[model samples]
Target chain A: MEGDIASIGAGLAAIGSGIAAIGVGNVAGNYLAGALRNPSAAASQTATLFIGLAFAEALGIFSFLVALLLKFA
Target chain B: MATDTHETVVSACLDSHGGAIGMPQLCGEWIPHQIFWLLVALAATFFVMSRIALPRIAAVLAERSGTITNDLAAAEELKNKAAEAEAAYDKALVDARAQAQQIVAEAKAEIQAELDVELAKADAQIAEKAAESEKAIAEIRDGAVKSVTDVAKATTKELVAAMGGTADAKTITAAVTARMKG
Candidate 1:
């Protein structure tokens, strides 16, 4: 209660980081399901799976960066 | 320290309590230092990856692909060789079978010719034996006829003698022959 409105905005941005975690989990879970369905095709698609994981994690990192910026800057 | 009024004015970025008056990260004075360090880190990463890591990865990938291609080619060559060997084996088998058949046919023909020669020789021997037997049978038949005529003459002579007739040998023979003719 002693902090400014930017602290509240930082808390909301941290929520965005948590929401981004859901997106990353969805990407990984879908990839695992597809991999289990056709194991033979899974080896060829590992690069694509990694690229999806990086993209999803990068969004979460951006949300975390926004939260940090809101807190400090 | 109380005589330096310029030091108090220059330290406006900090509060009286030694805390930052505003966010230190957004200060203009630190921007150049942050950018310089950022560029240094990026250049170092680029140098390590380009000069060392990327080249090694590329070499490994190239070598692996080359080895795979060579192995595939070798397998293909071996397959062709196996096929060729099988064809040669099949051809040799066929040739051997044909040779065996020809040998069997030649042996059969030789055996048949030898059998025919033996059969002809046996047939000739049989014919010569038959001719000799026929000649012997004709001679025996002639002797039997002479014997029967002689026996009839003797029997008639004895019968005449018993009846007390004094007949001559020539007349008796003539009468026996005449009776035999009847």
Candidate 2:
């Protein structure tokens, strides 16, 4: 029963990471669909896609930090 | 010291969410710092994208449009030049045809004048030859008439002697002259 809340938080954090994965997949899938339609414009939009992926990944990282701190500290 | 502060501030709100007090992200002490950094990141991203990247994209689009317009103008100019050249060629062709017709007319007139002169010379030669032939025919007729008169006078005097008639020269001449006259 030690750090039971922390353990659940870690599980939730894992789910958060999964949500981030879904977000990343959505951004990449949509970009790929559009890129296939017009390959000439794909290069210009690549940086924006990377920025979106990074922001979505940041949320998962914050959730992981919270779970780790709750478990260890 | 940092862990103690984190535990103290987060413990107030942690139990309500079924979380432990040791989560640094939930600590009141870290709130301001995280918010400050997040705002900074957001503002920096906004400024960089709006001021640098967006303007660069706009400039690229504008340059493409300008190139398209210039190419269209150049094509139009070439088309106009082609039209002008065609018109010039047509004008030159028409002028050449007119000049050729004028040359042909002048040559025909010159040839006709020469032919007329030759025809006049031929007619004059024909008329002169006809006059000479008529003069020669008149001289031949006059010589034949004089020879016949002399032969008739001699024959009449011979015929008078052969008939046992005495021939007087004066009478025989008178008779032959009268017959010739009749």
Candidate 3:
């Protein structure tokens, strides 16, 4: 039962990380499109894109913590 | 009874540790595994952002900046062209004004010349009329004097003829002197 729980946690972590990557890719793609349309506003929109990337990356960090908790705790 | 109950609870807590966890604890503490995982995630995020994401963002930003600069340069060029057009328009306006002034001056000069010519012609006509009037007065005085002298001579001849007679020498001599005087 412990092994099964550990494996499930690892799978969930991997899925979370993959979802985060997809979110980052979506943000980058949208930002690139917007930047192409309005080159002048690129500097202003950069902060928003960074914030979006950070939020998506936090989800991966949460998954990594959960995986560690299940493995060691 | 209380001590036995306390011992049972401690044994239960020990059993929960998964094995013989024999370690002298100074201040009761344990390692936090979640914190370690969070640290690893933070490091990975930093690496990925610095190595992959930042470079991509930088490239996009550079391209955008280049485009903006190009647009600004084009706008500046257009502004310069507009300024040049305005200058040309002003120059044309100045030239037109100068040309109009020159034309007005020339017209005024021509009008003055025409007025001068008309005045001189009027003066010449008045002088000619004055000269013709003086000549006419002189001819009328000469005619009146000739008519008066002819009338006086005819009257004296008629009187001498009327007094004529074949008489003595004195009479004849008197008649001859009278005729000579006439």
Cα deviation at B53, candidate 3, in Å, is 3.6
lDDT of each: 0.86, 0.83, 0.74
Ranking by TM-score: 1, 3, 2
Q: Give the range where candidate 1 chain A is weakest over 10 consecutive residues by summed lDDT.
A: A64-73
Judged by DockQ cut-offs, the docking class of candidate 3 is incorrect
TM-score of chain A of 1: 0.91
DockQ of 2: 0.32
- Strongest candidate by lDDT: 1
Q: Pick by TM-score: which candidate is best?
A: 1
| Candidate 2 residue-wise lDDT, A1-73, digit = tens | 4557768877777777778788889989999999999999999999999998899888888777766765655
DockQ score of candidate 1?
0.26
By the lDDT metric, which is better: model 2 or model 3?
A: 2
DockQ, all models: 0.26, 0.32, 0.03
> What tens digits encode model 1's per-residue C-alpha lDDT throughout A1-73?
3998888888888887788889889988998999999999999998998899898888888877887777876
| Candidate 2, B1-182: lDDT as tens digits | 33443434344535544454665565786698899999999999999999999999999999999999999999999999999999999999999999999999999999999999999999999999999998999888888877887788777767777887887888877887788889
Off by over 4 Å in 2: A1-73, B1-54, B130-182
